[model samples]
Target: MAATYKAPLRDIRFVLHDVLDVSRISRLPGYEDATPDIFDAVLEEAAKMCENELFPLNRPGDEEGCTFENGVVRTPRGFKEAYATFIEGGWTALATHPEYGGQGLPKTLNFVVEEMICSANLAFGMYPGLSAGAYNAIAAHASDELKARYLPKLSDGTWSGTMCLTEPHCGTDLGLIRTKAVPADDGSFRITGTKIFISAGEHDLTENIIHLVLAKLPDAPEGTRGISLFLVPKFIPDANGAPAERNGVACGAIEHKMGIKASATCVLNFDDAVGWMVGKPHRGLQAMFTMMNVARLAVGMQGLGIGEAAYQGAVAYALDRTSGRALTGTKYPDRSADPIVVHPDVRRNLMTMRALNEGARALSYWIGTEIDVSHHHPDPAVRQEADDLVQLMTPIIKAFLTDLGFDNANRGVQIYGGHGYIREHGMEQYVRDARITQLYEGTNGIQAMDLVGRKLSAGMGRLLRRFFHPADAYIAAKKSDPALKELIGPFAKAFQRLQQATAGLAQKAMANPDEAGAAASPYLRMFALVALAFMWAKMAEVATVKIAAGEDVDFHQRKLKTARFFMEQVLPEHLAAFAVAMAGAKTVMAMADDEF
Candidate 1:
């Protein structure tokens, strides 16, 4: 057996089938046919592909990595063949529209499957993950002719896709991007610029690369308003969707980085490359945002997937590797030493990892279901509510989940102690891989600013209105439940604290501009913990009710214990953040810039 990944099928099923209630999702318009059986089948297939095809390459891929010579980038060995298997398996279009040769599975299911792939091999997973985002942008905003030409091939995985937004001078600040788009005699435009840190920009996995580029039109509005998006391919496809002449797009060089070695992060050069407009000229940022949101959420999943794998590897090692003897008595006297799992501290670390991983799973999938409703719900108001909820939580998902992911990876390494630092042990790799999550996809700092500055004040907190109202009602309802009664006090206090924190930011930022920036990161983290605790409480409540009915007492008991661990260990960090946020800007930015 080649160290297979189990898919966390039980937990995923509990989330999809029980906790989220997929039936309600099926009632939505496009997802009406997303039955339980269909979801299971999708997960099963995804599990096999990730475990068999991708996992085998993870270690070797890290060692071999992507090779570049004279502007040609070659993916790790077996990647092309594995990618072919992935394409043939229809793993690329799980959530795309059926009209575009997709299966149209719910986004929630895709989220589950993605977690597995990233866990098995994040390096390889980036290829399709980026492609999915490109496909979404083109499908949603491209012209009819553009859609007819590209969507089928993308949906079918005949060609891979890339999003080229970051430039050397500008990453988080897109307003400063200098990529220029010049209109030509034909309907197409000539794109000329240098884009850096483009994941999956140029690789041999597919016949051609479809780059969704961000550039500015001449005489257009300044800053972000002037930005326009274009679809530039390595080999410009003919009218019949076949690769024609080679376009002017070239890889200046591929970046050599800390993690995700199998993924080719290239600095792309578009020298008068022919490209077609994706959406309206001035509204290119809008189209790019659609892709960015999808990418952000998916990147959050990368954090989540790596954390899950790290935790599992840690737990397995803890159980099997015996060291110290039991303090009370030898539970395993027959052995030379007691299992590390016997120690309370070991248990605490394991519980922390398990609890955080499970809570994140619930939270991520909950957000995924929200995405489903936002896109599929028949009622516009309901859809808007879902959309607002997704927007509010997306930053949190990207920030908080990734932050904890880094923590868990560190803790996983701590669990192995000395062995963890060694490359072959693989624990350290998870930590290295997880470090990038905080920096990219609009750095965690940027995400927090969006959450506190842009999202909160936008509608006078109307976006959070949908989230807070139901949470308040749910906490009130849970007060009467017996198994969940113990959690009520902490949960209620946390919710109240969240409410106060929201109000405090509104008040402080009104006076000091720096207050929000100072508290932005901590505030987003606190918000994420509170929101995740909220989701865990819901899952705990469901587990309690089910356990009382004598339905899988073991699983429910584990769920309750994990919820307890979260409430005990993870929930209190928010209090420290709240204290910091309450300290105001003087505490953070008081020192002069030259003080250093």
Candidate 2:
């Protein structure tokens, strides 16, 4: 039987109410109406829709995928109907501002919704997910005129969106792009380019598809500096904001991908497409980053979502599938064979996934709350601090979560044994789907570089201060607290290794950048491990109090035990990562280019 998903509502509530006090979000400006009751109701409905409307489609959607012929793309069966229900329920506008038809909630809640969708149907989530990114970029940077025309529909989910960045010849190097944009007399531009790997680029889901395109203007300066952003729609809207004439942009072909088959990955041909400048000319990358950053964080949530789904599936398999008895004796004599859950090895895998998921969830969702605080806080210093943490953690969240997400999904297959290898159980599908998260949103390696090369050094190490100061302070304050005595020592040790790694990488990169590049991956992992350790220790503190108070004893006790496992078994892995990172770039860059 295929594994089914039941949303981790209890754990989610624990994070919201117990570990992190999200009611503070309501206290922020513009989110005064946001309350726990409302958030719970929203999440409850989202869970139902995901479980009922989306989960059933995951297996069949992977089977059917998407079909394209004659420039037309059709999604798997029931997708359009499901999307319609999504918007009708106001799921798309949950976190947007109220000004442009949004519900004016908070980004934190939207993040929870994002996870549910990804777990329920990742491929299906791509459509609305892209729209949300485009919405944020446009909302933050686009002109008021553009916002009036596009924001309402996007907020209402009447129109879908895509980011047209990567080209057939270029994926990471925007400087190598050949897309051209010519100024038109009517304050618009004629864009000609072919963008590849454009997710949700063309589909039968919405009335119009908005493409936030990146291209170079004629007579532009060299490299990415000369690039500009343009708003190009599949069908240009008329005066009444209705789909009028079809634009020149069309899907040339769709990639037959390894997974997320239900989502359209297209080769978008913008042949003199009518588009308008999004931000200042020659500043497209800056504006587009508004969307890219959101997408990157969303990708991290994609990892967490997939991990949670796979974890649940593995747990079900471990408890239900019977094999050999325990080494000592048979625990369940009623069964013909003992359940695999009796094995220590199986317990290890289960514990590993559980620890990673719970830790990542606590950390990621806290970051989500900080995102809201960053944007809504009244004090500039407070806002800057929140933003710094968000910026610093963004890469870690993207690379680390996706990395673990794939690992946990694969472990699902491992636990299921032979049944997991084939399509009957649907465990393999999670693996295939999760494989892309590591590659997309600026690949995990790219994320590492950005962390070390860009964010780590930003503002003379101000961003690092955001995370390190808080973590260091926590370690010092909790070292004597008996509640976290068992967890804090391991976390403090890991944190110190992270500090050593950071100083070493920063020093080496100053002499030869390649040294930093070589170790960025491990450094990022070490940083993530320590950060998650910090989260686990904090969760332990909260759980201890709750358990002492005898509130939700089972839940709080479970959290306390998971926190221990993370510190003892998972967090100590950072030592190896620190060693790998401090090894420098010698062996990594040793081989000659033509050694073969």
Candidate 2's TM-score: 0.99
Report RMSD for candidate 2: 0.8
Where does candidate 1 stray beyond 4 Å? 1-4
> How well is each residue in 278-352 modelled by candidate 2, as lDDT tens digits?
999999999999998889999999999999999999999899999999988999999999999999989999999
Clash count per candidate: 0, 0
Q: Pick the candidate with the highest lDDT.
A: 2
TM-score, each model? 0.98, 0.99
Candidate models: Cα lDDT each: 0.87, 0.93
Q: Which tens-of-lDDT digit does each residue in 1-596 have in candidate 1?
A: 02224568899899888888877878888776888888888888888888788988888898888999988999989999999999998988788788889999888888889899988999998998888999999988998888888887888888889999899988888989999999999989999999999999989999988999999999779889999999998998777679999999999898889988899999999999999999998889999999999888998998889888888888888888798888898889889998888988888888888888888889899999999999988899989999999999899999888887788889888888888888887888888888888888899999999999899986888898878999899987778877687777687888898899889999989988799999898888888888888878988888988998999999989999888888988799889988887788885787889996
Q: Give the runs in model 2 whose Cα sits over 4 Å from its true position.
A: none
The whole-model C-alpha lDDT of candidate 2 against the native structure comes to: 0.93
